[model samples]
Target: MSGEMIYPRGSGAYFEQLRALLPRGAAWICEAGTTLGKLLSGLAVELARIDARGIDLIEEADPRTAYELLPDWERVAGLPDTCTGAPETARERQAALHQKLTSTGGQTIAYFIDLAAKAGFLIEIDEHRPAVVGMACDAELYGEAWAFAWTVRVLPFNGTQQGELPVAVAEAGDPVGIPLRGWGALDLECLIGRARPAHTTVLFAYEVEPEPALWFDFTR
Candidate 1:
């Protein structure tokens, strides 16, 4: 087995790779209808990771509000691009968002994560560095809230050393079998809360499969 690849030791690096993988003009959704409070907290964590990674977030209008309240529109109610950060004096706006998300239907959470993904945030909880492993999954899932499309990609803790290896990704369905270049750990827990209940959301996981896999041998 030969080893000749590199990967950053932080979730940010993984997220960067993932952001490049997402569809252009689309974003990773992180909305939690009926759980705006939870959504806010999750956003804070994501933003923290984004900051730590030094990723440039594309600013756009908040779509969740308009999407939820509007008719015949499958848009997101995103926060204002010029909006202030949540940690500062944004409690009032936060409360308002919480209320709006309380009764969101299917696809609401999906839309949010989509926005984050498109804006260069993360879709799943990816962790390479253990320092911020806790930041992978959102806190709202602990409260028995229904989260969907949960996934994450990580170094294989016990991966194979051939031309490729298998790593666990935070995908909801049966684990996707992909190819890797080395032995590393993959965590599938990061993607547990991207969808709403009774709704089918789509997310991806990076694992090890066999034969003709273009995902093999990452450049780090």
Candidate 2:
């Protein structure tokens, strides 16, 4: 892949092309990056759903669009103030991660990939690994129902088949109604590269979103 075109998570146009493959009403949202060039496209509207409870941009976005809308960790809502102390334990981090995932800023990105399962997801990917799939169950639209369609960008993991990312699952043991409680089930664990003893692996998820129909760019 040339650095000329934007990569999956960072490139807006790259994402727009990927999303055109999905059905309307159903959408593809994610937690990734967008390009300045994306604004020139029809997706220029970065909506904020303001209400009495709080101000939220709970609209659907593909990988890139969602990335653009997520609040900077430094600017996070309900975040611990600098005067507050840092978490001293793993339990606290788990609590904080859950708190962050549900927060508008976090869920803005978190909610989209939630759908990757039904829509079919590519959990992780890079130069060396095959594409991984079937990590999440599926997601229904959470925000305004009438947001963008599935014209989103989602980069797949290193395997083409299902169950590539064993760690990214929503735990089954978690409480009901907790986001990621898949009937109290999490993805099963499977070794992806036991044969490749020389390599090491870590996993992460990214998202995709729509851009204008005509806008396109590649290069500095």
Every candidate's lDDT = 0.38, 0.35
RMSD of each: 30.6, 30.2
Give the top-scoring candidate (lDDT).
1
Give the per-residue lDDT of model 2 (tens digit) for 138-203. Answer: 533233322321222345334355533232345768666655512111221111221112334323
Off by over 4 Å in 1: 1-86, 91-103, 107-112, 115-120, 124-220
Candidate 1 lDDT tens digits, 1-220:
2332222345334544444554554244423332532444444556557775443222212323332233222224343322222223344444435443563434444555554443233434422222233654643323222233333432222333334443334445544565333323222222233233445333445444433436566787
Question: TM-scores across all candidates?
Answer: 0.18, 0.16
